[model samples]
Target: MAENINSIKQKFIIRNKLGLHARPAAMFVKLANTFQSEVWVEFEDDEVNGKSIMGLMMLAAPSGSIIYVSAKGEDAEKALLALGNLVEGGFEEN
Candidate 1:
């Protein structure tokens, strides 16, 4: 039998006024790099490596856009939870 892998996926709405701009994208990439799981983010028809700043910027998601975040690896669940919180929390904006 093939070994089972942890794959977690969740959708989040961009809450920040600026959406996932440079600062937020950098923050997201930084967080993703700290995880052992492979992360991917999707917006509309565009999906990119969650750990790549350029890839994230390419999404060009605006505020109120829905995004799908997925992670496949041992820490997939934790990754999704943290990423979801980040999205929901408006990237910690006041």
Candidate 2:
């Protein structure tokens, strides 16, 4: 199977009290790196590589902030779903 630019995208809200901090950003990067696709996260006019910890942290998405996760490649769909779940689950940082 050839690797095509099959993109997938999802939007998530930061409802966690702490919002997107280092720990959660780390988790997000870790998860983003798991897929054989290119992943990105966007907030406002900024977009960063989802697999990059520093890049993710630069977003500074606080509580009630809206973010968009997108991926493109062979596993784009899976990557998108996984990221969506992670964000929806608040990165499990209760």
Candidate 3:
């Protein structure tokens, strides 16, 4: 499935006052679930499942914190770009 293989890494800064807390994390998870790719988030040395709300919350991504996002699979490029947009846009400014 090499033709379907795709992946990308990007960093985004949290601009929302609440950071990437429960609501935003839930939104992210929901959006990510709509895709058919493996998505993940990384911060410093920690990495977590992008579709796991609990796992995302554990990151404690505070406002202005830079986070890394990546995706791989059939729709990895779209997924990663969408997620990066979400984070960069601060979850649509909540």
* Best by the lDDT measure: 1
- Candidate 3 vs. true structure, TM-score: 0.91
Tens digit of lDDT per residue, candidate 2, span 48-71?
999999998889999889999989
Candidate 3: Cα lDDT at 82:
85
Overlapping backbone residue pairs in candidate 1 total 0
- Displacement of the residue 30 alpha carbon in candidate 2, Å: 0.6
The order by descending TM-score is 1, 2, 3
Worst 10 residues of 3 by lDDT: 1-10
Q: Report the C-alpha displacement of residue 59, candidate 3, in angstroms.
A: 0.2
User: CA lDDT of each candidate?
Assistant: 0.93, 0.89, 0.89
lDDT of 1 by residue, 25-45 (tens): 998999999899999999999
Tens-digit per-residue lDDT, 1-94, candidate 3: 3374777788889888899899999989999999999889998789999999999999999999999988888888889888888888889775
Whole-model alpha-carbon lDDT for candidate 3: 0.89
Candidate 2: what lDDT? 0.89
Instruction: Give the clash count for each candidate.
Output: 0, 0, 0
| TM values, all candidates | 0.96, 0.92, 0.91
Judge candidate 3 at residue 54 and give its lDDT.
98
